[model samples]
Target: MAIYHFEAKMISRGTGRSVVAAAAYASCSKIYNDYDGMMHDYTRKHGCVYSEIFLPSNAPPEWQDRTELWNAVEAAEKAKDSRLARELIVALPVEIGLDEWKAILKDFISKQCVNKGMCADVSIHDTDGHNPHAHILLTMRPIDDKGKWQAKTQKEYLCKRGDEERGFTAAEFKTAQADGWEKQYQYKVDKKKLYMTPTEAEQQGYERVSKNPKSTRYGRQNPICAEWNSEEQVLRWRKAWEGVTNKALEQNSIDARVDCRSFKECGIDEQPTIHEGVSAHIIEQRGGVSERCEMNRQIKADNALLLEIKKQIKKLSAIVVDKVKKTVLDFANTLENLRNRYIFNRYEITQNENISTELKQYNTTIDVTVQRYNGIVQQLDNKITELKKMKAEQKHLNPIHIFRHKELTEHIDKTEKEIKKLQNLKSAFLDKMSCKSEKDIPQY
Candidate 1:
């Protein structure tokens, strides 16, 4: 089966990471970081199926080279704790060939990252021939139309209106100040000095730029919110990958699809088996005992038991439906016959000279009808009891069984409805018999 696994992390300087080192490890090649003047080499590293760099349309064409691309990233980022790159690790479908995998990944990166101005360094790995996956290193900063990297943040000046501060451009700030509205500055060097212009302060060796206190610390060009770093975005990216991979699989006519949902979200009640990587798989294949192998064995057993329970519930549902149909038919026939026999006896008493024999026959017919109704009612009760027992048993099994065998629930509902109808009919018959006896009694 094609499994879903997409993970994301950052190659950050705060965590002691370099984009060049990350690129070297993922692509299994050598690269040099010009910022630190350090060389990172993994040229002897193995198991890299494919490695390439994808850039935006406006980016420099020379950035197609991995060394040049990542070296530029290192050179652009000057802070010691700068976030150099964003990395995504995704599991590729092993059922697809290498070419298909490459096509799918290329389309995904082109649409998702490159179009959004992030250069993607994609590397496919197939170590041990079983775990095929891809690593994508993405740039965090936006690129300009001139193919130059833009600062992640830019400064904006704010102006104070009537008791409220509002953001303004440099020209708007100059106009507002000239319009005689009080302006606020974040850095006030001297309390006694009323105000000093930025140029005067700079000329006097005060190298600080006074900012509006209400102005934002930094403004970002990209519209994406900072909340994109949250778990919700991770789930969204995973789902997106699942959709892309499934589409590719469908295009290739593969019967399998991947889901980024959890077992519960997928409406499955079974415990998911743990992922045993290539090493564990090989060890288990060699008849070795491992925790993952044992867990898998138990999961298989539980699944088998769940299947058996489903079969039993289905069989029981069929039996109950069949029995109810037959019983209702028989009871309806008996009630019709009893009603006809009573009407005949009443006519015989009104027209014939001897009424005792007719009366006796009527009584016998009524008794037989009552006995048949009782027998059918008992059988129905027994069927319901058995069904209830089955339902109770199902409660001990997986909750997934309820979702899998919806017909079983429907049958139970139908049986209960039939029981209610029969009981109502029985009551009506008894009421008719009582009314007839009251009218047949001789006057005192």
Candidate 2:
């Protein structure tokens, strides 16, 4: 079966992470970082079936090498806390072959990254047969037409013209300076610090305390790079992954499809289960249980019980007999509080299709049994009504006939009472499951 998973994060120097080491691990090879003068090697690390570097048209051809590409990224950033790379990991559908997925991934990266002037270093991993995913490391900076690394951001100086203040870059300042725009600086006026033009401050007899002109904090980011780092872009990538994977599944004639929407977004109240990675899955398969697996199991069981209760409630409206209604009311009276019916446990909801299907079948069987019991009760009631009419109409019935009728009616009523008790027991079983307790369940 194919699964849907798309995770994205950043490798930043602010978090003490290195893109060189990240690239080495993803490619399953050795690479040296020129910026830190350190060699990052992951030759011993397993499960990187494929790895490659993709460059923009104007990017240097030498950057096709992982070491060269990532080293250039490291060398370009002068800040100790610069964002080094964008990392994304997506699960590959089993319906598609490794080579086919690679081609699909290449198309995604080419259109979304390389064509937009960013380089991509991608690797596919399948150490465990169950979980196959790809890792992508993308360059944070864009390349110019001359194949030179462009600045991620540029300084925008604050200037005032008349009473209006605006930020302008170096090129824009040249034109704006001609229109009587003056750079603003921090000035000491009496005992307070104020921002004013040099000429204005001098005329007011204020001292220019700071040499630095006021500018926007962190400067103005390049528009393209800014859009790439926005939250909206990540959402787009997630949706795109879902679309491509579904297309592949459909082409392969596989009925199973994946969704990017979360449980809440889909309006489902069931809690989703957490991903139990390769290690947790292996432990459970080797005669041992993992904490994640156990939590998932519990969540599945609770969800199953909740579904059963919902179905039983829906079927209740179909039953109109007075005996059925009275039995349900009596069962409801047994519970002191209805708030204990739901249990909220940790972990996401697992996709236990088999368990869900079997529960539905079991509920269907119970409905059939209840319907049969109702039919028998209805027949007994009709028989008793006929017997009373015959007893009143007859002048003097045979003594044997009167005795036999009395005995037969008594047996019919007894059978009806037994059937009503069974129906009551079924309702109690549903309540027991909903509360996740054995207290209300009958031993019989």
- Which numbered prediction scores highest in lDDT against the true structure? 2
Instruction: Write down the TM-score for model 1.
Output: 0.56
Cα lDDT of model 1 by residue, 241-287, tens digit = 98899998899899999998889998997768776666777777887
Candidate 1: C-alpha lDDT: 0.74
Least accurate stretch of 10 residues (summed lDDT) in model 1?
Answer: 435-444
TM-score of each: 0.56, 0.71
lDDT of each: 0.74, 0.80
**Compared with the true structure, what per-residue lDDT tens digits does model 2 show for residues 1-444?**
888898899999999999999999988899988998889899999999999888888999999988888888998888999999999999998777887788779878987778888899999998866678999999888788899988889999999987999999998999999999999999998898999998899899888899999999989998878989999989988888888788878878889999999999999978788878769878889876566787677767667766766665676667778768775874465332232443233213333444556766977776665565446556656755665565554435466677766766676567566656755665555553453343532221
Candidate 2 ranges with C-alpha deviation above 4 Å: 205-207, 278-295, 323-444
RMSD of 2: 29.5
Where is model 1 more than 4 Å wrong at Cα? 156-158, 168-183, 186-221, 224-236, 270-444
